[model samples]
Target: MLKTILSISGKPGLFRLVSHGKNMLIVESLTDKKRVPAYAKDKVISLGDIAIYTNETEVPLHEVLTSVKNKENGAKITVPSNTNELRTYFAEVLPDFDRERVYPSDIKKLLTWYNILIGADITDFTPEEEPATEETTAETETNAEEKTE
Candidate 1:
């Protein structure tokens, strides 16, 4: 039996898999429904959001089951229904997003959080800044003196 797990997605008419099997198990569904069968429970190869069927890995179906069961609600492995248009939509919009405005979070390196997300890999980011300017400082001293009076 072909113990396989398919991370299924679609790009318009072409259906693709996030292949994870030790053997090649790529196939196209002739039916109209959109569900990866339990039969293909382990033969999946996960590469980003893509699935491939090649001689690479050996994942048990139970692991996929466990992962799915344990997965956070929004984090489940799935493709949207408008997946056919996703690539086109992404291609058009991705470059427009403000990469220039993004600054890495101050706590990202200090807090041991998940690094799997593709955030900016900048070593130049600094957390601390010098104290406020002199005019602002003098206003604060004057306010303190007034408060004490």
Candidate 2:
């Protein structure tokens, strides 16, 4: 899922979260499989935390990516360089995408990211489910006991 994928500022490509140490995170490049340490000073963002502006509300990156995948049929797309063409292409993918808020560069970035993800063979754009905590487990047991009683 996108949770473990990272985009470090000033970095060229996406990275996978490998591990973390004090004041730094060890990230592996999705493109080259190179491991590098990202310091606290670096602005690192998880793709899962990204959202695109829409007419009504913001849409999560995963949903946008899924839309792109559906549009492209799970294949890499040729990113349109022309601004108007790019906008038109993006409109086809996300019809309700905010016209005023979403810039052409943003659309281009989204398309480029989609291509990168596809190249990496990461077709699944669904968010990863959070594991159940101990509290939730106990609550489930208590509910089961009550049902039995």
Candidate 3:
């Protein structure tokens, strides 16, 4: 699910991946649903591909967002612009996050993105549900044929 959501550097807001072109990506802004073409030159990073540095290791962005969501009771967060406040909130959300590797700006960006995601009701970061297997499809077809017969 997160794979379809992209964060293009130099862009103001989050964008949803609509399709891929030869040398560009077709993305729709999550905030206003505006469709735009992002060129290969743009630094486009999928939320699924992003992770934060933790004291123990790296933690996926989705996991960190989930932690924030649980902390906020799935409510929209008002991201703090102040560095110290942002750091305090992030600490509550993720205590073991590496302060050195993860800067204040990074925390602010995460907060803003996470809030946008929550506001858009994109909280669930679970993997996409798989399609039915061929065997299952065949069984269903056979059952339908038997009923018709």
Which model scores highest in lDDT?
A: 2
**lDDT, model 1, position 60:** 35
lDDT of each: 0.31, 0.93, 0.91
Report lDDT (Cα) of residue 6, candidate 1: 24
Which portions of model 1 miss their true places by more than 4 Å? 1-130
> Lowest-scoring 10 consecutive residues by lDDT in candidate 1?
109-118
Best by TM-score: 2
lDDT of 2 by residue, 1-149 (tens): 99999999999889999999999999998888999999999999999999999999999999999999998789999999999999999899889999999999999988988988888889998998889999999999999999999
lDDT of 3: 0.91
TM for every model, in the order presented, reads 0.18, 0.92, 0.84
Q: What is the lDDT of residue 95 in candidate 1?
A: 24
Residue pairs in collision within model 2? none
Ranking by TM-score: 2, 3, 1
List ranges where model 3 is wrong by over 4 Å: 129-149
Per-residue lDDT over 1-149 for candidate 3, one digit per residue giving the tens place of the 0 to 100 score = 89899999899989999998999999999999999999999999999899999999999898898899899899988888888998899999999999999999999899889888887789897657679999999999999999999
